[model samples]
Target chain A: MRKREPRVILSFPATVDAMSMESYSAAHGVPGRLIPLPTAISAGCGMCWCAPITDREAVERAARDAGLRVSGVHEMML
Target chain B: MIYLDNAATTLHKPPQVIEAVAEAMRSSGNPARGAHGSSLQASRTVYGARAKIAALFHCPRPDHVVFTSNVTEALNTAINGLIRPGDHVITTDLEHNSVLRPLYRLAAERDVALDFVPADRRGNLDYAMFSQLMRPNTRAIVCTHASNLTGNLVDLRQVSAAARAGGALLIVDAAQTAGCLPIDMEALGIDVLCFTGHKGLMGPQGTGGLCVRAGVEIAPLKVGGTGVQSYSPTQPAEYPTRLEAGTLNAHGIAGLSAAVDYLNEIGIPAIHEKETALMRRFLRGVRDIPGVTVYGDFSGDRAAIVALNIRDYDSGEVSDALAQDYGIATRPGAHCAPRMHRALGTEQQGAVRFSFSWYNTEAETDQAIRAVRELAEE
Candidate 1:
């Protein structure tokens, strides 16, 4: 088994929103990548923006600045 | 063959569009279905297309862009989804059957009341009738940006103003105008702009969509898997996901993305200028021919299309002569615009429609004009 670490996950209502989050992050140098929406967040099958716990503030700021419709921000160990 | 049936579908597409479609077919997977590389690639391509389409139409929100199989589907989605029972809908006689049929069905099945702004013999819409037709319960004004048969451009500014004053949603069918006309949906205050990729956009036939204004909540026409919200019984109440229920035509959308890129590179105004110039060249040559009677008002800005007939000859016969002897392709018959044909008094004889595109040159236009002149002389 791999070691677990604290992470931040940004979820969105739609795939387009998640795609927008991914695009904004790539363009603006935000530290995150798209991952499968954590089942615990919701039972929905979608993608979410997952970032390191240390960069949670940066992620939140980017989401707000980009005017992204983020549904939830969760902290968990992965 | 000299293909002049561009109002039906653009025969000449950007090389990038073809390559993108081919590449996508080889590599893409079901978008939003998984986090795999192929799925992600498809998702990215689709989102890229959505963003590009939103920008092209000047729609404020990219997420509001919803992909349908074609503009017909998009229009159906908009009309059938947003309109409620007993809602009063306004349309124009210049609309293609795509718009007319849906409204007709709703009137038949849902008790929706429909009013039409009339067209003149020259195919010009009576802008004043929009205000005259306004009702207290007017739910929407659905109109085409241009007539597919006569090519007369609808003044969205006038229509949008009437729609706004009446507090009705303005849904435009841009089948003949998108990517060929300068459309700023945001500036035009269009509530929903439905477009097809195959015609003016110069993309594949199966790809087209609608750009919804931020607050317009159009219910889904078809409800199924959206690849997201799989656990929910109801389709998620998101703009695109709400309208887009099934797996999208990702391959065609990739091509559409490239098509938009090409349009941006060349600029739509430049292409429009070229096409209209060709259209004018053809009009000048053929309009003066003896026994030729042209349809539509050409005194103002219009699409690069000219519909005419040689004397009382059947439009199909003339079109056949142009095709067989001259090798020039044009559309004949009613062109699926029965109301416009009736207005033009061509319901019996129909009309031959020659539409130009950015790829058409002066030489081709001249040849088409010569063919029409000779046909008229016969």
Candidate 2:
């Protein structure tokens, strides 16, 4: 099996806000997949976008340009 | 059978709406939770519905629209979220139970000050009084765009202006007018709009929502799994998601989306013209019935509902006769609008309401009028 690596997850205040980030990222071909908030993360909403830990800066920059209000960002091993 | 209780729900949906619901059920999954094809498809269908609703209501962004099971839930969310303890709110006598009960609950439980601007016996609003009733602490001005019981219309633009002058949020219950009549959210400056898809929107039951303006922030009424953020103790604080929680009625939204598409193709003004014309026909045909009494201002601007009663019969009896003898379905007994009935002095005898829809025909109109006339004669 491939070795599991730690990834970056960005949580938003609302599901729609997270989805907006997903939408913007896809249009710009940024790296991230919206997923159920990782249990390792202590956020309130049910969804967050996960990207390779290396893609943190670009993912966040994309979320910012897209006007998404990220509640928190976490790095955790899957 | 003739269905005249459209104020409750429109029974006949445009064929496309029916197909869309089935199509969604067949292929879609939880939207936004995953990047899988099914999830993306569901997401698109929901977004498409939101976009169409935004266009119809003149909402600036599709994301501002939040889906709920029905308008009642939307109203509850808006009322519960916006009016906190010590907040003052202004509503009206023409409100349905959906608006009234929620405000009433907030008043009792949260220590909110509630005042209702009384309407005239004909269901005409005292628009100027809305300004007079605003307190320094007023947080919301909530009212219905049209009275569900009498089909009387409120000039929402005027109400919006009053709310703005007081720096209060204007929340409109567009349950009866959303898809049937044109609403320009920007022009009207509505802070929150609550609507049901099953009524004039021509969608299936169990689909409705609220549209929030860009700057107005409301607390979430309920919090649960949003299929996104699983870790927070508090609800997510975003426009639609801040308001919408749990699994969305995606299948119903699929129908609602298709329904909005149908409404767009037909045009709201055209639909309004057709429904009200039929109502006027029924009115004119039955106007001479000796024992009959009608409610509502027959002013040009009106909803597709007509409320009335025969002299000797209870509103329920009249409605029962219409349904049993004439095969005409109507709503009777206060319409969950007890305050409006009290205002109209129909407190003891509730009114029978005959509401129309686009699919109804001139033939059905005549039959309803004739039935009322025959009942009057008997």
Two-chain DockQ for each candidate model:
0.79, 0.38
Per-residue lDDT over B1-378 for candidate 2, one digit per residue giving the tens place of the 0 to 100 score: 999999989988899999999999999998766656788678767877887888889888778998999999999999998888999999999998999889989999999999989988898888899899999999999999999998988999899999999999999999999888999888999989999999999998999999889987888888876655455566666667777777788899999999988898999999999999999999898777899999999966899999998995899988999999999999989788989999999988998999999999999999999899899999
DockQ of 2: 0.38
| Model 2 chain B lDDT-worst window of ten | B227-236
Predictions: Cα RMSD each: 0.9, 3.2
lDDT of 1 by residue, B55-116 (tens): 89999999999999999999999999999999999998898999999999999999999998
- Computed on C-alpha atoms, the DockQ of candidate 1 is 0.79
Q: What lDDT does the true structure give each of the candidates?
A: 0.93, 0.87
User: Cα lDDT for residue A23, model 2?
Assistant: 71
The pairs that clash in candidate 2 are A43-B231, A43-B232, A44-B232, A45-B229, A45-B230, A46-B228, A46-B229, A46-B230, A47-B228, A47-B229
What TM-score describes the B chain of model 2? 0.98
Query: Per-residue lDDT tens digits of candidate 2, residues A7-76?
Result: 9888876666666776788799999786667556753335678899999999989988987788888888
Write down the TM-score of every candidate.
Answer: 0.99, 0.89
